[model samples]
Target: MTVNLLYSITGLLIFFMGICGLMFHRSLVRQTLALNIAGAGIFLFLVAQAYKSDTVPPDPVPHGLVLTGIVIGASATALMLFLIGVHQSVSKSSNDEGERGS
Candidate 1:
């Protein structure tokens, strides 16, 4: 089998793992991490496909796209974390206020 094929297969497995993690975990952070892992798998798969056996180096187009994807994913993850933190803080404060009023 070709190296690209192997990489694609591995990427698929990792992607599935991330999906399972998201489905099974109750915590928001865990779900975000799972999404990140899935994103990584997709990047790896794309890079693998762009790799040419005849060429010493891989295509630049896929690399650029993967890099952009990584940056976007990073921003998205930060926003998700921030949102989760805000939600948790608000929920805690509200519960505390309710208890005090009771």
Candidate 2:
């Protein structure tokens, strides 16, 4: 099989794994990780599609887009983690107050 096809297939498999993880897991952290995994798979697939062959030069536009997407994905993941931390803290505080009242 061609390297590009192999990469595309691998990317799709990874994306499928991520989707399964997201569906099966209940924890927000796990879901966030799954989302990131899915994003990575898309990036890989795009990279694979960007290539033409050894003779012809690869497309630069897709590469640039992938790079930009990676940055956005990282920022989004960080934001999600931060929100999770905030939620956990809020719930913990509320639970502690409830226990004290009881």
Candidate 3:
């Protein structure tokens, strides 16, 4: 098969794997990592589709979109991690308070 086709297939596989991981895993960290992987797959697919052929220049729009997506993904990941940390701390403190009260 063609290189583009191979890239598309690989991206699909990665995306599916991410979806499965997100659905099956219990850990917040694992789910976050899976979300990142899915984002990467989408990026790859977009870039691969942007190429028309070897002679023609690839579309600039997809590249720009990918850059924007990367920035958004990074920000989202940071937010998720921060939220997870806050949740853990809150739960820990609540548990400690309960123990002291007993």
Candidate 4:
């Protein structure tokens, strides 16, 4: 009934969905998206918990943490994509070389 409860429930759902996606999907892109979804859910839960009441100010610590988390998540995703690109390029080149040799 409460806003906090609703946020918590939503966050849990998103987090679980992400986990399921990660477990079931074979594609690298999908797995990366799942990780981002899980991170967002964690941020949502933290922010929701930091809320005291309508009149009281929310805690700043959670906000700071969430920002840090976002940065880290972005960096990780970028790195993963870069690695995937490098791997694909290497594989392609190797395949091409093999074809030329034969």
Global lDDT of each candidate: 0.92, 0.96, 0.94, 0.93
lDDT by residue for model 2 (1-102), tens: 899999999999999999999999999999999999998999999999999999999999999999999999999999999999999999999999999999
Tens digit per residue, CA lDDT, model 1, 5-34: 999889888888889999999999999999
| TM-scores of all candidate predictions against the true structure | 0.92, 0.94, 0.95, 0.95
Stretches of candidate 2 exceeding 4 Å from the true structure: none
lDDT, model 4, position 34: 95
- TM-score rank, highest first? 3, 4, 2, 1
Q: Model 4: per-residue lDDT, tens digit, 21-95?
A: 999999998999999999889989989988999999999999999999999999999999999899899999999
Please report how far candidate 1 places residue 49 from its true position, in Å: 1.2
Best by TM-score: 3
In model 1, which residue pairs have backbone atoms overlapping below 3 Å? none
**Can you rank all candidates by lDDT, best first?**
2, 3, 4, 1
Tell me model 2's lDDT, rounded to 2 decimals.
0.96
RMSD of 2: 0.9
> What would the per-residue lDDT of candidate 3 be over residues 12-98, giving only the tens digit for each residue?
889898999999999999999999999999888889888889999999999999999999999999999999999999999999999
The positional error of residue 90 in candidate 2, measured at the CA in angstroms, is 0.5
RMSD of each: 1.3, 0.9, 0.9, 0.9
Higher-scoring candidate on lDDT, 1 or 3: 3
